[model samples]
Target chain A: MDAPTDQAPALVLGLDVGGTSTRALVATADGVRVGAGRAAGGNPTGLGPARAAAAQADAVGQALSGLDPAAVRYVVLGLAGGAALPSGEDMPAGEAFARVWERAGLSCPVEYQGDALIAFVAGTDRPEGSLLLSGTGAVAIAVKDRAMAARSDGHGWLLGDRGSGFWLGRQAVVAAMAELDGEGPPTVLTGLVIESLSLGGAVPGTESASVFPEGAAPVPASPASSASASPAGPIAAPIAARDLVTAVMSQPPPNLARLAPLLATACAAGDRVAEGIADRAAAYLAATLSAVRGPAAATPIVLAGSILTNPTPVAARVRTALAERWPDAVVTPALDGAAAAVWLALDRFGRPPSPAVRERLFSVSTAS
Target chain B: MDAPTDQAPALVLGLDVGGTSTRALVATADGVRVGAGRAAGGNPTGLGPARAAAAQADAVGQALSGLDPAAVRYVVLGLAGGAALPSGEDMPAGEAFARVWERAGLSCPVEYQGDALIAFVAGTDRPEGSLLLSGTGAVAIAVKDRAMAARSDGHGWLLGDRGSGFWLGRQAVVAAMAELDGEGPPTVLTGLVIESLSLGGAVPGTESASVFPEGAAPVPASPASSASASPAGPIAAPIAARDLVTAVMSQPPPNLARLAPLLATACAAGDRVAEGIADRAAAYLAATLSAVRGPAAATPIVLAGSILTNPTPVAARVRTALAERWPDAVVTPALDGAAAAVWLALDRFGRPPSPAVRERLFSVSTAS
Candidate 1:
């Protein structure tokens, strides 16, 4: 059924919609990429329905630009937060995609799927396996015959999502606070986080300029002269732990997730606190995997998302931890999700891509 | 210096500013309460500066409505988020409170103190002790001479605040989600939380009202004819775990704290999941206390905030856990924080109240 087709050229469109960025690919049935486009977040669950649909249209339009839209035989949208519509509604996510498809003037038959299923397929051609994701959120999904069967811990940041990028970043900030207040062992994370946030010695009232005694002669502001003149130059001032905390607290809450990479860097530099956070994240990911794996035998476990795919200490720890549990588990990183959607679309349209085509698709998509 | 004053019968005012409520009390130096007022949240750090000051002024004006403002010799404010000014500037919190005081036209000298310090004073007359607060947030502070000397785990909802009311509530939701998705054991908390949130049979498209087959008679929408209506009456439809999760996700994130009491109720009713959450909360609280205690000898440990004072399983577990480690330590519930501030003001003004006066103040404040 997945044999290479020698018929006249037909194209398929695949879209990976997420909270941060959306990517779309147009490729031929032989796995040769024809065009691609990118846009901002298109997850309807994250960014409301109208914006989500518009983003999808923009990406799809760009991908199909100058190309014959009529030549596209099928479209597959692999969307994050697409498993369920906004709460209290029972409309299938497919119906919403169909409306967007019609509005976009694309006559191709379109199918919608959860991003996790696409990620699993991106990693392997297996009919059944498991996918562990650790991006801004964490969850493990057991895939049976290319569909989600069982799941664990994708409860978002508020509930679980343990071992996720947000979780690690939050831990980094927590450790920094503890060290700042002398409640825990001093860690380099305190300094690194402060610097990462660009919080210097400019604390109000305590800044060198404001701390001068009344009627005291003002010292020259140059770093070298000021140090000798007043013995209280900005260079001499220490960063207050509370000030660092206040700086962090002032940021929009979700921005805390931005600190995850700094934590990874600190872990590589041998910061105990960062290493601890990494280890805990790995352990959590393992536990999530264990919960979802169930009785499945030596199936491939595809690791997806930034926290798992990135070359960070956490990814290394997770790989090591999972290796100890399921030695025979075919652990692999997911290929490009949009391309995976293309493969699924081909399969659903009764013309699955052959292994050679799959390789070509993965290579072409990954290179781009 | 420690004697009660009969010299002018001067009065003192105390204000306890919290996230949920602002409480103010006016009384004589000898501890005879004269007036009190209540208002919405006054935590400047939680609520913005303008609203926080307005709440303080409003509560103060009400408490002093019939009293002579000139008779008030001193004022002390015990504020939850008053220790640190909002991020960005260096102005001390005292200056901010002073502006509010001047605006309210109170001539008395005012002092501002952290809520934890006042809670310690409220529990005992000692100049030093430890305070453990578990409200919407949790923290432990070691107080020495009415000043915060050491602290642990007040990092707010994003970073720490473990074992807090918010933490417990978040855990409850996590458990409910886990149970709903077959990721964990089912418990009564799943039902209780869904009911508490009022998320019943209203799951958008999946509700009975919307689930009717196309072209089928709606059955007159009568309860008797509905197969789902049965012994449970109009509430026969079991809440879909997905729907409950959707409902919670739809709410403002902080509202998750409202689920804590429901969890406590479930624990009291013998739900294992609720009990587990309670146990974790207690353990986290204990760890926070341990981190802040530091080699102190027989110092009173004042447990303040609703989570600690309320008769919940977490509070009980905390008491038991503390008793095992600090048998010699005096465990006391904090008296009214506003009243404690009054006592501190009197002491600072060289008109310390006697033991009998302290008792009178506590009785009057608590009774109100």
Candidate 2:
């Protein structure tokens, strides 16, 4: 007799939407990936949620095009701008996603959640585990009984997104400008931006008040010298630090994440400005984790997202800060987050995901 | 009976060089105005001390053309970038002023010092007093025995410069964006900036990325959906916030003085962002005063400048911060800092300026 063989598990599409990029994966019922796709994520706040949902649905359909619609049992979307529940519309994000799926003509169950929930599930599928995320935006979420029962801090990128990529980017720009004005020491990035942007000595083609609103009839450019001399330039003259921060957060993949470690290193090297920013970022993350863990004595906390990939420096700093509040807690990294989302979706129906399904989800991606 | 027998004192020209504007006043021996003039203040770091000095010379020549150059017995300049003692050929800011006067072909004894010193002398021409400045830049100075010394906490708007116009502007922008992103509460200033700049969208201009360093330049009139947004627009995106602050600071002189109270009221009304900024600004001023008054604890500190002009909330907060450090020290305000520059100059030479000289300095419309 032929050896007993496991049937192909049902496939589920898991999509993670960030400020800079949108990522999607098709995994078996247990979390083994069978297909994948990628696309640019639109700003739901700027672009209505229906449009965002449609775009996301399109991305999912594109990723799962070759597969039969019936084989794809469910779809889960974790998006960035799902926080603002539309007024007079309960389950607005879900409705938006449902509409998108309907438009795509995909006969599959669709679920929508705040991007933080997926990051939390991705990092800690286990009940009673916490996750801290510091991507373009920052948030800490706690899972209990396989549900998002608790959450701490995701107040956009302004008042707090502390150690987030957006924070790092803002710090870098401020430092660069300071150096330009002879108020601060030169940084490696300062020369990089100046050289990268060709931002010195009254360059031609400087845009003026045209940077104001989306539209209001462009104001005639003042004198040429007036434009070139102020090379902190365009955005520098338009948005307030507050709006610039929001704009930075609006990015799909957050450029600041790439620069955050550099800021941490500079802080370590005695750049007071960088150091202050780093210290604040770490404090913020720790506070967020503590808040998510609640007042419990021994709640387990899980680190998540691109930031926690390296738990040695920044992660370590966050651990130290969290220790101040929650001393008797375990801080662990997530083994498989997106897989957890797939598993959670399956578990929602009655039967738990089987071993074969788990293996498939655990399988490494071929793209990498 | 002869109009209080007012006569012009021995004239001494007082000059102030800043990043954006240059001011000069010719005063009589007794500290009376003789003439006044102003021109664009050259950036020392950008144009170098030589060019900046030449610009000052030109302004002075134009202001004093009709007056007897020989009759102008003394010249004083309180400059921002001219703090360095004269070195070799490079000519630091201090010596550059002397050279500028010589090159201008003016016949008079010229003296130069920091702007902080001039503010102090103007605030407290008495034997002992102090001055605190929180403008686009910030500094604190103390004078005793007709000699002046000072300390500065922030010239770097990026690293520090806390409590300055720049800091306020930066903070305002950050807060406004937070409010717009639904991450922070609504603020009056947010609406003020949006209306003032005529921006339609809550997220600021669409050119945020144009402000970012290494991206495709923003396409003009590409509508909100355009992907080729501006790369240099990020830096100026906060312009609205900065503009709001600039409006507060640059309020038509007489009305501008009233903004301090409004700012303080906003802080008191639970505007945490504004309160935080105001507190930091006060701390910055106090720290500078503490640094300058180091080892000379007994001297009274005469507070001067836009930040401490009146008993406004900001000024009160600054006094409170300083009192925390200097428990028993006095803080006095100065009315006319530029005029005090001329008084201090004559005092430096141990010459009692006659009424005619004082009038020339105070009332004359020509530049010193």
Candidate 3:
């Protein structure tokens, strides 16, 4: 609770609060990181208002330890569900943060922006660019002067999110279901998904008899297979496919997103069905970017989110697609969003970081 | 419950239980309907086991009024979500219905089948055919000897159900959102959806200034427009599109299925956006049918579900697409699934119905 004095150095705080995690960082105006903290999901719309506020406070408080919060001149919060705030509210997140600041006996100005906007800043110092993100959800936003000008496909997991992690994972399950139901070609993904989900025991009535005909080739057993090999069980014994379905149905619906990486792994291992899913996901994401890109002929496009940051087949495909369209478009990967927020906050003080400063901030913030 | 008399005439009962409604019918072997009743949604997987069992009991009890339960020779249930039964359970729906029958003193055998199977029976006396159903959800199943042989795309609303009512409605909302955000072309749906949802008041920060630039054509006002005409409110006032978004977001996620008919209505009225949704929905359905259609060149294909039954543009498009592929395939509409189930049950007693009997049963069942 040290008060700001002539001896205290001015610093900036940057926060990235999302549905899955929250991150906060304090840095000097020159983009040198001073402190950093992390917390669980803090998206208000996803994790109610009170919890979201508390998460942000916890992350910020941890980041501000051993430092004078009063010396923090600017604060920028990049929030995932910011756009979904009730319109009638007056700077809700800001007010909540103000109370937190008061409790800590610190004063500072706070600015809130969409997660996509901060993600764009995270990739590059350019104020204007397009960002294509493919995390659990997928979206592309056209940013101008550090503000969102247009967007495509952030319609949650149901209606759109075409190329998102959720979409890819759901596609893998669909393919597996089709294969098990005898309506689609046999895929390596079927056995892979069964093993990954640990669906060993069978459920009655959904026997493989219908899926695998009398003379059809038997399903390949997984290396880690736990299912009984003997066919001499009771007539009413469960089927492997039925067990897989049960395993999937037992989980909360959104947990399906966890399967995306499995699909990526399978694709890398050369499974045709998995490869197709990855290709289609990348295509969908590329299309989303096309829909939201600005009219500027050579606007830089930043690639953000877990799917894009990872060196997966889908990410490779997306990079190739964007390269074909915008040969000169700077498609940089965003390593640390908190670092991006730090740079953005510093920009508010008319000291936008140079390339060297940006690199230093990214390295320092991501290192901790 | 009425006791069976030595001289009581034997009859069969048929029940069509769905997610929205349940219907039961008692009829003579000659297709003469004696009684009928209806109740709320009875899909066990959709409504859960208890509510579904209760719905079936209510509908069947009402249909059996004064009839002797012991005289009921057989009972066939066309159940939605039937295939999704957990395999380990013995006589899944049967055991549930048995309790109801025991209370009512019914002593007759009961058979349970998927709704698609009954819909196929409703369309044709032929034991083998394909049935394409597109209600709140959509699926295409191949039937062999009145049993489901193979299926395609019944992956519920989240994973698949591409050509379903839910799909169409969700597509409409996606389009409206795009138009509102100035990411897509202008469409009449923007106004219609707003008016239908009655989202009149403004929300802060979402003024249409960015969406509809100055001198650009004004958005077409709906016939029931309630938005302010002045267009000069507080700078923070909400936009009409924002209000529409709020209205949609306020509802439970699955309620998006309710918006499908509005899309259909708009399509019938020649809205391009709606028309596109209908055409795509039909095309997807046709593809689904093709996926599950038997190799037998002249397999009968039955079209069921509200989207197909209502004579909408989507049905017409699907019919055209299906007809072009299977020129000799018998494409029949299902009007009374309960009656169809009764006919199938009667066939179990060595009475495969004649065409005239089918017509009589449909007419009698639908008449009420």
Isolated chain B TM-score per model: 0.83, 0.68, 0.85
lDDT of 3 by residue, A163-270 (tens): 888888788877777666665555556655664675543322223333333344434433223133333544433444444555666775567778888776666556
Ranking by DockQ: 1, 3, 2
Error of 1 at B90 (Å): 7.3
Stretches off by above 4 angstroms in model 1 are A1-9, A82-99, A201-245, A366-368, B1-9, B82-99, B201-244, B366-368
Lowest lDDT sum, 10 consecutive residues, model 1 chain B, at B218-227
lDDT of 3 by residue, B305-336 (tens): 88897787888899998888898998888778
Candidate 2 chain B has its poorest 10 consecutive residues by lDDT at B218-227
Residue range B176-238, candidate 2, lDDT tens digits: 645544345555445433443344332243444232223332122221222222333334444
Q: State which candidate, 2 or 3, has the greater TM-score.
A: 3
Q: Residue B237 of candidate 3: its Cα lDDT?
A: 40
Q: Identify the leading candidate in terms of DockQ.
A: 1
Give model 2's DockQ, 2 decimals: 0.04
For residues A1-368, what per-residue lDDT tens digits would candidate 2 score against the true structure? 12122453566777666544566677655555666666666446546676666667666666666665456677766666422312112344556766666765567776666666666555543556777877665777767775566555554443346667666666776665544443445454343223222233222223433232333322222233222434553433332222222333334323545555555454444455555666777777876666656676576776765556564256667877767777787766654544555665666543666666655665563212
Model 2 alpha-carbon miss at residue B334, Å: 5.4
